[model samples]
Target: MTLIDEGTAYGRQRQSHDAEIAEVGAGTPGGEFMRRYWHPIALSAKVDATPQNVRILGEDLVLFRDRKGRPGLLYPRCAHRGTTLFYGRVEDEGIRCCYHGWLFDVKGNCLDQPCEPENGRHKDKVRQPWYPVEELYGLVWAYMGPPNKKPVLTRWDTLESVKPGQKIVATGSSQGAGGDDTVEIVPTNWLNDWENIMDPFHVPILHTTFSGVQFVPEMGVMPEVTWETASHGMRYIAYRKLEDGRELDRITQALFPHTRIVPDIRLIEGPAAGVGWVVPVDDTHFRLFHARKVPEDFKPIEVRHYEGRKWSELTDAEKQMRPGDWEAQVGQGPISLHSEDHLVSSDQGVASLRRLLREQIRTVAQGGDPLGVTFDPARAVVKVQAGNYYRKK
Candidate 1:
């Protein structure tokens, strides 16, 4: 064969992969799968008298709290003449369309039509599309799936099972100090962030080794890991041999439909006390929603920002010098091409998570509940095991 430069070859094409896991629009596998559960749409404090534009699963919608403080998430367009509800008025009973005074309540029920005849059958038949929204943990969560199949919002055991003197700290935004109410919106696919939770190998390499001691000194050493399926999702156990005659065992939980109960960001050597979520904004963007509990005697751990600067405040050179998870995940492009990935043995957890997500999607397509989802509130208290423990050799 003649020597050839592949770089000069014609028709070099990039293969597509995992559209079922990446795409979150209506009717797509991932979209259909995600709609089956409750997702945090916006922070509860963010919604007010003025309607705020919110998008999830590729659907354009508006979230607003009326004069009476009742929260409503409705399709942005008014049922009458398709006017955008963003320009509507929030009334005592519901939101009224500015176009013709069509009023809709939290349940999407059309309550009034000022411009229509008193007996106009159109007013009775007209209803704006809306989703069920609940205010929990300082976040506004919405169920965008079938009305009959909607499952109860979970109060995870990690938050509910707190012992005496332990209380929950609800962080409204994904991007603030430990107790701040602001959050930063990350620019990447939801899957990119979710998959990272299961990837333990990267901890020693990315955060510790190459990144130059971003975490505790003990985490710099490489770890041997094993993964297994959990009732609500999956868990991975990592063993790191310490310099002394002891082994550090870290267990992280990857909950189904985008939740992670991992170690506290503070690097504490105990059970994970935080609930983190990767909430999809669309196919190409997502945001993080987190809540955790702090012991009475312990100080709360702050969310990680790079070198005391917000991600937007970081210089390109600074990011290159100390790249974090955001840089690593977003660098893969909006939606990563799994076909192009050369996954190895160390990628076992990631591979397993992808398979489990695909299986859950398939289950939902077959008209069944995905793993860890329950309609009963009593049974919704999920038990998760994820913490760091030390054992003497």
Candidate 2:
């Protein structure tokens, strides 16, 4: 018998994903768990008179603002003739479909049917499907869960207290930071980016060592790290010794569901001022929405350069050499196959995150509320503890 080389891929079987934690379509285990809380669907400025088409959780919906200045999220199809409401005209009362003149309010109520007698005597009986929308922190949030299970839209304490010169700013950009040249929607599984927030080990290796100090010189220092389970989600503290005999203690949190609370990577010496949401457009595509407090004319996302070239200016070969988060996460494929991952002791944070997500999925499946979601108005505001601190040895 001929002996074959060990561990060759010639006859290896295909890998499988952890579907319970990856799939995010309606009725899926992960989808149901994600629906338990509100998600930022669009920037407030983008939803105006003209309807904007959006896809979230594998469902296509239209978002618009009625002439009354109320934001609405509705099923794009007209209930009467099945025509898309994308071409509908915005009127003071509601949106009027161009096909049959059917009108719908922000709550999906049928206001009128102009093509029928007495504006359609049975108009009150017809309704269009819609999700509840609320504007907060310069972003439009939607609750796509069961009506009875809807909770208050969460407010972050870090984004609330704006000083005299500072105001709440929001972005729906690539990685929640990149400029116009970057793709607004990330082409990868949501879990790929979501789990990354917990894996602090990557910063020293990927951002500093491999990427050649893409962030800051201090980040190049290997940190002493510890992880813990926080009330909302998981938290990690990384301590790095500086050349001046001072230690930098950075605290970051991965809030329940898909929120990331990270201190300003510029090593800003204060509490974190922003939060980012990794929202799933589907099982394979995701987008980021971030809100932070900054002074007027301040651009929150700093343009990054590698090898003396901006990210957008790099060639394919250059990208391969100096890949950032976009390349790293998306390279894991649309949905990473969990069975193929060789996790180790350094991956404790990633493992813990997956376990927590599975627990939440099971919780929702058992008809119980998931963690970090509260219906009480008093508990709607969540305090952020992620920040940068300094200590002298």
Candidate 3:
């Protein structure tokens, strides 16, 4: 056969990223799907008492509280003089842009303008692009979707189970994982890291054995997992119980279009962490915002940025002594090459996840309701099989 024909015969099928549905971050089909719901925009600590500059889903936004203690989400630029709100002055009413002194509230209504006389009477005439925001589990969430479609603030049992005295802390990583208080930006596509939430199989290798043994042996046995569609562009997966009975059963939860309750393999008794994402920075890059709720006596989660070894970069010796997150998922490339992959029984969870995602895209295209679309009034407990797993090598 000719080279072109031969290549085609041996080539693999492209994934959603290869098509319009495939986007690395903002501006892709996947990103469009993700914007249909509320996404975590910043860690609560990042926006306290001061106007903070934030970016999510490729949109730059500001998270600030008005004088009435109401949180506001707005595009970073002020309508008055196109000033960056990061330098804006926080007031009892809202943030006042520094350039033209245009003041706005959480609802984006321009309240005052120093440049305009008449005590800023014409302020109401101008509107700043602001979205609705809510604080949950100490994180700020924003809805970038149509205002009519904005859903209510929500929490699963895993989050509700957390009390003030419990271990609830915000993630420092851009997408929230590494033990830092700073955000990290990837040079690749956003989907590359977002989809890592669904592929549970990678943990055992990339995170556990990839470095050395990040997870306990009992945590490594792969379990039966399945995925289903949720509202907007979200996907949910459930990992059933493992064969061993003594090991306490646990489920790690991931919400689409982007969010996750990062499993803590270090948990000796209860859960280890929780993480969620903000919007993508672009198709080739994205940022994350996360929080971890560790057990009451988990030794303060000593891991920080680079004081400890990262999963991504480690010498065999260094890796042997370190746990990893680097290789965990992002290594699938800035965006994964779905064609280069080979799935097996162990990967059923990821496979099921992709199928459900495609299914929902199809549903939305046909103007049908996707799962998790309606408001879950009761705020039920969301369970998914997540955590450590292994396949016989």
Candidate 1 lands at a TM-score of 0.91
lDDT of each: 0.81, 0.88, 0.60
- Residue 323 Cα positional deviation in candidate 3, in Å, after optimal superposition: 8.2
Question: Residue 18 in candidate 3 has what lDDT?
Answer: 44
- The digit string of per-residue lDDT tens for model 1 on 105-212 reads 988998888776773457667778899999877788999998998999987777777789977666545452111234356667888888888898888888776556
Candidate number that wins on TM-score, 1 or 3: 1
Please list the residue runs of candidate 2 whose C-alpha ends up more than 4 Å from where it truly belongs after superposition: 1-3, 176-181
lDDT tens readout by residue for model 3, 1-393:
655445554556645344444462454556546656666766676666587777666667788877677888888877866778989888888888888788888888887877667858777788989888888767777877656655555555555567656777655464243323233666556655656666667666665555445456644656445554443333333343445544344455556555665566554444434656634666656667665666676654434322354334445565435535543345556666776678787666566566666665666555554555555666434543344332221
What ranking emerges by TM-score with the best candidate at the front? 2, 1, 3
Model 3 lDDT, residue 238, Cα? 36
TM-score of 2: 0.96
Better of 1 and 2 by TM-score: 2
Taking the candidates one at a time, how many backbone clashes does each contain? 2, 0, 25
Question: TM-scores for all candidates?
Answer: 0.91, 0.96, 0.75
